[model samples]
Target: MTRVNHQHSKGPHEMPATGGDRPRTDHGHSHHAPPRSVEDHLRAVTELLGRSPWFGREPVRLPLEQAAGRVLAEDVEAGLDLPPFTNSQMDGYAVRSADTAVPSGLQNQHEQVDATAGNPGAADSTESLTSLRVGPTVPAGHAPDPIEAGQAVPVMTGATLPPGADCVVPVEDARPSGFHAQGATVSVPAGQAPGRFVRPAGDDVVRGTRVLRAGDRLTPLALGTCAALGLGDVLVRPPLRVGILTTGDEVVQPGTPRGPAQIFDSNATILRGVLADAGAEVVAVHHVPDDDDVLRALLAPEAAEAPHPDLWISSGGISEGAFEVVRRVLSGPDVAEFSEFLHVAMQPGGPQGLARVDGVPFVCFPGNPISTWVSWEMFLRPALTAVTGAPSTRTEVRVRSGDEFECLPGRARVVRAHWDGEVLTKVGGYGSHLLAAAVGVNALVILPPGRGTVPSGQDVVVRLLT
Candidate 1:
């Protein structure tokens, strides 16, 4: 197990004290408090979002085409058996197993027995191969007629088996490998077992079987299964409606003119993609300068349009800085219901805040591009999984480290890495600002606090992003 260093931090399950417990600095920012463990902040976010109205809203019926990535609100049962009836699994001759049986002494004989050639007991002869008179052909979708004793019915793949037939001899195994006309004789091997090359009814899925359970995401393949079960639409949990706020005076939208000291805002793009991947619907997005008043007005209830978000997520302006617009506005007694600003014991995403703004839950993250991405992956995505069982939950695996890396003593080190199945290789530098270097990274390698330096080939825990 990969452990997070939490020696000086509180347990992840413990909620931080709100309001008066936080001492305010002269700049209106909360005084630095002991950093909380990564798990601690995650639990808080998960609990808050889980209780929101959007998470518990009634399920909506959506066509399979529109239900991709949505979680099922209820179990899906099959209306009918897959294949629906006993059928032939190959193009062959269907016959009674007893008619193909040969005496033990003749089992190894390579000779053929012609039952219509004056040999009254040819079917039971030890000196000859079993042969049967051919009946009418059975094409797919056609109701086949029953066969009599010493008779063979040609069947196409997926064709329903005739009532009197107990087994099929594939065309390749018949002495004459092609279909025969009515009343023709076809020679087959003896001692063929019943049910050979035959597909029993309900072989794939039985009627009334629970094929999909609640919380199962409607992926392409999953939707195909639903279609096979005769379902045109499914009941799915409503997507989480989210509002995003990106703050900073130095951040400008991409494709707009940029000042010498300002950079393009990547946080918005990053958040939008990840939120969508997590099955959330982005209801609103705004980039606010480091002005508390402007931030306050944007968050005001009446200012937001319909389909308002059930939660608001702001990036930047939550760290300990002089002009932290989000922290300043959301922390004010008049605008906030309950709020806590604290640090989590994880690099690149340590600064974190949880609050309620205008009765809607708010989660605040740090501003750096990589920091924002890491924050979503480490905190918000996991919280969403906990709340709605969304399919965005990442799969974690333990693998050998392909590269050696240093770790801080009291905070977990989250390194961008590429997992090539056999080993996890570091992708970029540990600095949160090295966003460009993070390209091609598919996993996050987490090293617990106090481990210091990990040697190559050592086992480490990794969360797959792809």
Candidate 2:
């Protein structure tokens, strides 16, 4: 396996010089210092993740269509203006504003029948000639001849406006109606101002303007802007590669026959979805038995083989149990340096461990389904976002508990709860394995240590889970 460029950093379990003054409770007895705070452990994990090579590496070119939902690696400037040329905003008559500057209510009552053809019966009226004769139509995609001084051009919507035309009168406003079969005459509205209903070049966006900046996520709208700016491809960062391993002989695959103590493995499914939601590309997923030998053989590096994943996220076998396969194997000389494996002053997810196995970062969590889920949200989610610059999945909101709630004396409570826009209500009992209580919970109520019971209507800090 290709070894990651490992960095030496202090583990979360290492106590600071000031920690010696704090008291630690062991087996109902107060000792020298308390367990590490949640923020302290989170800081250490973030530090480790920041040293990863794939967190924020060099950029790679990708097609614009495939760059959606990924971070842009460089600023993209527009090559041409949005409109590229002046165009008509409506399918109507394009006229010079000076020709339509007549006052409102000026009527054109004189009728004409080709005076140039020598018809004296048709009287020639000067001031009564308020209507201008419509010129040739300017169809879309076909250039039109330049408009004359006293003439109006019939231009369709999105058609290029002929030179010397300053405004467009919608087809509905024309006296003779829209483009006609025979030659048409259009009435000019009074007080028609310049630039009215005319989409000028470079109005929406100018050429060479910075349209999209580096580190911006290529959302659907952002990608559309890139396409509009004449870009077919963009530079983006690749997704993080991760390997998931779920342990426990008692946990069998779904749809398989189970013995008396075996149950369907839900951790794998839950963690797979969780890692994907965190923007990690899960390259490999395996269900290893409680045997240490089988686990070691599958992970050992082979000659001329490809590198392992950038990171390994394992669930179960890290807790302090008799048959902890992961702990038994990684603690040996051949595999890794097991750094931290202690209670984290939090409920539902108290057991946690961090190690570097075969130069690949490994983060082990408790076996319980609820604990594994909570640990990811509480710790791994923030760490990944900080290192990889992924979007944040958390939000803090103040909420009032619906009923009286009690918390553990020394451990902080991260209870699954529901927030219905008004008040937050606690879910089922506080067992670490109570997976049923986690359903439909949009928030996690965080209660600090040393609190017995909180009365109803008290405001509590909660992390949004949606």
Candidate 3:
């Protein structure tokens, strides 16, 4: 129900169409409708979205390194506390918290395989460090000679605790030469927290703790947590693949310009980049002349991919034009028909909306340079949240309109705009053909139809692009 205030600017989706909403195909004619508006189109899509289902997939194990941008497939429970052992926090000394002072490496020579996961039938096979010699100056991995009673040993960072040692004193706390050859020991103040300076086995994440859950995105921090737990692989959901179809007779590949009316195809390329940035893989983009049969054949590639894209997006064609995809798809009586006309009431993108043909989801955006771009930002972007596991829309901010705006009287207006840190200024004259303006602009300001112009300096909400 939001309105655009700009009255002069128009986008391609404000296309003119007859009763059928199909235009002249052979002639490559455009359409224009007097009744529909951008607001109306947005409403229609919103209705369709409410009925759409979320993405679906099963989990599979992937290396933590490769899990970025993937959704967690299942809940991950910790196999053990992070360090899995009583270990030193510093390179200095280990002492019994109660003893106030102790010998270092009293049990440094002891090395044991972790058998915490017990084999009940073979308890004796479970290796545990019961006794070891106290060591002085023992490196972290090597074992020291057994400590005689009341003896201290040298230890280093990551060294195992000697038997009966409960705390570690940082080297700074004890003089380096103060020890009698036992890797230096120092006194502790009374009541230092037990397990102080020690990362308790499973303290970061305890054994059997649910560390991650299904639906969680594999972010950098999340990967770091998994790595700390010694995980090399993780289970995550499959990436969403998308099919991009660019349809039109006037469009030709870049560097192959023909007549003045023949423009290079920027929509497909732009759409591809946007789709990828949104986390949906562009499985393929099929370029087709305005023909129904040709499009169906082109969609074959999209269908061939292991998991078909949840959504199919086509740029251009949905008006009451002969070349419109919506019209051609709905032409057949063999179960694939778009029951609704291009009936959105919004301007510039009024002709754009969703359709169901043979149960495949499709959204159509206008072909005009700016219309195509605007349509995606307005309709498809929000709907993509489910497909990509990201938010439905990009970030938006409120800024002062640099000039009073006049838009179509009844339809909502979307104006490509530029936003500096302090203000949002309108871009080049609002026309679908103004590609240069669209390029310079970082956002589009929505002006609800029927609303009066907002004077310069008035606050307006602007959706960011790029």
Candidate 4:
């Protein structure tokens, strides 16, 4: 495990410790808890995710065509050797190498040794076996009869090698080219070695060898490999089912009319796309208001009859407001366990929470659009990736800042920025609600905590989002 170093202490986002059951207050709105470091929060989230019911579920078989992008759940062994038999690697004549020997094919007699495995010393007593007559041509797909000791069989590329012929001499190398009827003598050149131009059986993959292992995400190449091994179907893990809920009294659906104080809901839409890209199946997406009773009833088991999601994700209503519906309704011991609701040492995504409602995992994000997006990228993406063996969500690059960069002294700053393959420059202001500018950028510049200023051209760590 890679150890993450995180500084945990009282920072700007923390409120005075709220003793007992009292809610911590910040600017008159009740707060959840004190702050934790980003690393600590990620560790907590990862630990909780490790306990999920689907972690070790049995694999399900799916057709090879439908298995792409799904994680392989079982190791696949090849049933038969690749190519399945010895075959010609070129358009050539299958011939015994001794017949083409440089010393007129009589070396075996002098050595008194056998070269052929099953037939011993047959060449020792025979006449110089060169310039043999051509036998029947062996085209692809039609198996040829066994070749006599001194004869050459014409074979095409990918044609199976005939028994008693240990090597192939290309048609170009044989005198009087092109395959002809029996008794037409074709001279084979010497120095043509055995096993040359022959694709030996199991050269690519041997039977009983495990070619594909569990936890591998099936790419097109991986699927093709399984098909090459003669697999009609493969065992794969199921995509995670997630239920997304976006809440706030002032938030409305995008297509609906909005009042003066209301804004179009972007959290649900953004998260749905992010989760889908991460190989999660978004089973449900809903908008919830600040009314606790209405929200509770909608989440109750009776209301959720079908399509139970494996996980639940919510944005807004997790911060320090009295009208925090998710906090107010589900904070009790009876409903669910709200494990940690606190600020992390990170700007734009400081507020976060985790819960378990009716045995289903729930993750809560702050209301700000950019903050919600950053939280998903930093926390949920990595944890889920570890489970699914999906490719890494972020691409890290060391870059120099194009200009002077500013950061909050006590909190790590994740600034939306544009990276031009060389230098990174911050885009828009450092406000969490600046979604318009956020969309224009392609990466995030992660500034560590307690470092307020970065001089121009200073090296920094960058995480590519696109």
Candidate 5:
């Protein structure tokens, strides 16, 4: 077991780990007092870890080259109108209302109104006209002059409306292109509105409007919207630098096996992945012996400089074992009690906690792989997003379970699962050591802490995994 050695006493201004040593069995379980409820313990640590208050956040103007996963810093507005001008809603002929012989011309308002039951265009078709031939074609971008009284212009869908002409008569409504079709007369239909088939400028989004508001997450759809509006870059918050530590005398790395007393270090890799997914750039992942002197030496300023860590995360050494980090932190004459780690009422990942020592946020999680994962997803995720100004939310999606599963009562079980559209199928065995099952799982089916067993076809809220 490790213990902190202090040379001299410091004033109250100094900050140190809290708690005295509590005896533990050789295997490392604790003999301390029964732990408080997980929620209560979490709340206690948060209140103590004001080291979080020392952190600073800055805004950045990122070119498209570095914008992925960054939190947006400001509002983005449309620089110009979408589409830019009034256009055709479909491919058809743009004809003068007066040129066509049902609606009366607006010049004779009274007669026009009388041509039909109070409708406007009734007299134009009935006003009596001979024949009008097709004029020039109007494509999408440019506009042509108004339709003259004796002609019609062919217009493609999305073409800006000419100086005149409103409703479009679909191409099918007109005779086809050859002599058998073109030049043939078709009966006139009565009562077409003036602006019928025209799409007005700024119809989709008007210029100078706030297209995206401040703090909005830049999704692919949102990013596309900005690009369509002509923006090549976005303003967002810079990524945070985090310091990670994995603590355990028995922990080992992957691809290596130890005799009887060792297991691989899954916490470090799991946390790296989690932190990256949460948008943090790890400054250093400290792997130190489970000795307080070694940990303190590794944590000293000389080990890392320049851009200091904005936050730190460590696994294990927090329980009541003689070598418990929490105990060593609190026991030294240089150390001061700040908070305690709690065993929450949750399955597989119960021994999780967060603390603040000396102005740096420290998230202490269990050494067990599944325990660390659950702690990260349940607690640190929301907290990190909030601190970094990310517009991320822990989205809950409804899905049916494909199979029946049972879990410990009074403990929330975070089961791994695959979302197959309509239902979520539980992944391999619900053991904390099941890394394979947790790695590729796309969703987490959370059984309410202590909630009952879920049978097939039952509704469950799945936490999406990215």
Candidate 6:
């Protein structure tokens, strides 16, 4: 078990000391301490996750099929040339360039013979066309017999070029405009280049060339590239193992009967889906009622079973409310070695907490469904990408706002929006409990702290969601 030493001094983000080693539990909200900036809280989360043992664990080997959505741990080099041999790039006839070149006497004569001159003799002339006897047909994936100097072999696309053939003339350029039987004559255009319609060996990728580098995510196209390189497996970083806990007596499992004051739990489902998309494996999920002993027992070292999680994430019970089970249990002196619960200067996800419980990192998010999601996107997602490089980072683009909106003073407004390639329109209200309203949101518009109305057509930064 690795222990992280965090300075417990009263810094800018810390509240006044409560006269003990353990930091005071504000339940993620305290009127005394100023709310930490979004950037500062994000930096803290990044550092916490970056220093853990799970971040430095050895890479694992997985088959190519199973490597999708995983980060590559090492560079992958091509073992052989992509084409491996000279092949025809089109379904055509392969012939030596010299055989297609016009004779010097004929060239000089045809140079002055213009069919556009309206001369019957020039229009009917065949002196510029080169005729060659067609050899054996070369289908794709078949080796071809050598062709003589004046012979043209009918070759399909991707068929290996027959020996002695230096170029291919596409069937569309031939006089017949179609393939001919062996031993039949075909008329081809004169002056064909040596490498026309031919794919040379190593054209796409050369042997020993680095095709994929370390820290690259194995997406669908990436996996296809590995398959094209004849690789059966690849080395990738193991996913971060995570445990989830949702607290609050008012929260009940979905599909079960609920009391008058209870609401169906959506935090657990949301966290599971989001964590899976971010490439983290959820090892366990538990719902802890607003009871300190129940929450404490579940997080105890003895209570943890095999396949222990590298980190724990809990939603609800961290706010300033009276029944904040997570804040009460985790911030206790005997429960956590280091813990801090504070508010961030961001709307919808202001309350947050981070701690080290039994040498494992634990991150606490607010109870609201949108707050939990926004916290993951605003802080945890970026931190994971920075530390591990799996689950590629989101793209932020500055675009014109599609609608006019007001901003709050001293707090960043994270509003869900839809990006239409040109402008960003707000999707749902800014309330954290409007989870159902965020259905079609694909972008997050981040408006910095200010007390004024933003007119339409003003530029705003947006983070695109995958």
| Best-matching candidate per TM-score | 6
> Residue 348 CA error for candidate 4 (Å)?
2.4
Candidate 5 C-alpha error for residue 411, in Å: 2.5
- With candidate 5 superimposed using the best TM-score fit, by how many Å does residue 464's alpha carbon deviate from the native? 3.7
The alpha-carbon lDDT assigned to residue 273 of candidate 1 equals 91
Off by over 4 Å in 1: 1-30, 106-129
How should the candidates be ordered by lDDT, best one leading?
A: 6, 1, 4, 2, 5, 3
lDDT per residue for candidate 3 within 277-326, as digits (tens), equals 66566766776665666666555445454455556677776555544754
Model 1 global lDDT (CA atoms, 0 to 1): 0.81
Model 1 lowest lDDT segment of ten: 3-12
TM-score of each: 0.87, 0.74, 0.64, 0.73, 0.74, 0.88
TM-score of 4: 0.73
Tens-place lDDT digits, model 6, residues 386-464: 9888678899988999898779899998999999898788987877877877989999989899999899999988999
Candidate with better lDDT, 2 vs 5: 2
Q: Each prediction's Cα lDDT score?
A: 0.81, 0.73, 0.60, 0.76, 0.64, 0.83
lDDT of 5 by residue, 1-466 (tens): 6421111111334233333223322222243535445466545444533346324657778776567666678888889998678888878776656555444454344222223434465554433223446667777777587776555567888887777776666664454321123333432233445777888878889999998877677777778787888888998866777788876556666677654656667678878988877778888887655556666566554665447777778777665444565335533324322434556777766765554555666777766677678777776776666555553777788888898877666676788888878767888878776665566688888777544577899888788875
> Which candidate gets the maximum lDDT versus the true structure?
6
Worst 10 residues of 5 by lDDT: 3-12
Higher-lDDT candidate of 3 and 5: 5
Tens digits of per-residue lDDT, candidate 1, 116-180, equal: 45545446543345788999999999998788999989999999999989898898667666899
lDDT of 4 by residue, 1-466 (tens): 6421111112335332222133422221135445677878788777767666566456689999987778888888899999798999999899988666767555654323233423454454322225787888889999889998778899999999998898998887666556778768886655678999999999999999988898888889999989888889999888777889888667888789877767788888889888877777788888877666666787787888256777788898776655566665666555575455667878888877788877778888888888888898888888887766764457888898997778778788888899988778889898877777777788888888765689898998899986
Preferred candidate (lDDT higher): 2 or 6 = 6
- C-alpha lDDT of residue 296 in model 2: 74
Question: What does the lDDT read for residue 435 in candidate 4?
Answer: 77
- Model 4, residue 194: displacement in angstroms? 5.4
Better of 3 and 4 by TM-score: 4
Candidate 2 residue 436 C-alpha distance from true site, Å: 5.3
